[model samples]
Target: MARVSQEHLDARRRQILDGAAICFARNGFHATSMQDVLKEVDLSAGAVYRYFSGKEALIAAIVEEVLGQVRDGFEEAALSSPPPPPDLLVSSVLGRVLESKEFLTVDGRPAFPRLVVQVWTETLRNDQLAGILHDGYSAVQKTWGRIVEAYQDTGMMRSDISADRVARTMMAAAMGFLAQQALFGPAPHEILRDGLRALMSVRDPYDTTGGSQLG
Candidate 1:
């Protein structure tokens, strides 16, 4: 038998994944069986199984792609000459996720966000998924912590604040924005930027003594 080119194998895997993404997006993970995905791709059971053993495997691949996007955005910003402001970084990061082609369905709609919401619900019972999410989050937090350090070096934020705490705090807000976006329709990225600006602009009027404004 002639050996299949690596390109051909990749295309086949993509075909299966794209089909699975559609099925999962429309009917969800639990409701959409392997047979449904196979039907969607017009592939035999052996062919689809060669690429993914089950829905969890498919979900893992999709989650990894999104997490990679998050890390790439943060890493790029952290390595820039001047790291982005906290608000700008948050909005940009969210924008990258929403615009990622890997998350988009065949219909040009973002499918991963809704799929992730479903994954979040599934994680309560699926330890493997919870572990995957935990690992992905930890990796992003580390990069985000680096960004916090970069901001501190530039005097953009408080030096007294722990970088880990700041990273986690900012990450929490960003994830909250993502959940909101997934549940509701898309909102202006300016909403996030404006909210952060308002938060950062608050003055400590009661402080008479000289102290850090906690900006």
Candidate 2:
């Protein structure tokens, strides 16, 4: 018998993970079982287990995959010419999060938000998962902090505030929005856009540079 190529193995693993994500999103983590994943993938038990040892392993892979997509978005934004303003930056990132097909149901509802909340709950009871989550958030924070600092240097953001703090605040707000969206569907884009602009200290349109003071 001929041995399977590495590319085939990788493709098989990705296929299983995709099916597992759909199952977890529909039935949630605890409610979802390996059998559910197997059925979703239409693969034999042996084939599924060859990629992930258990549900926990599948969950870990899903988290890593999601985080990798987020990291790629950040990198893409950072490399763009005439980089987006802080507000646009935040909007861009969150837009990608909300619009990602990887985390959305076929009916246009978000799946990842529910899964993320489930993971947060799991982290409370699982120390290993907790560490993984903490590490992922830390890396994301560092990336955002760099962006915040650049904006501050250009006087686009308040210098009085700590870059790290701003980054953390933005991250928290984004997570909150995700949770809210998952529960109530998406808020108005304009409302979200304005709120992010306010948070990022985008210059007031009516305020002229060195304008005469009001009498």
The numbered model that scores best in lDDT is 1
lDDT per residue as tens, model 1, 1-215 = 99999999999988887778778877788899989988999999998888888878987887777788888889888898578788888987887677654455635656766676777887888898889889989999999888888877777777888999999989888877767866775576678888998998876678775456334
Pairs of residues at least 3 apart in sequence or in different chains that clash in candidate 2: none
- lDDT against the true structure, per candidate, is 0.80, 0.74
lDDT of 1: 0.80
Which candidate gets the maximum TM-score versus the true structure?
Answer: 1
TM-score of each: 0.86, 0.82
Compared with the true structure, model 2 gives a TM-score of 0.82
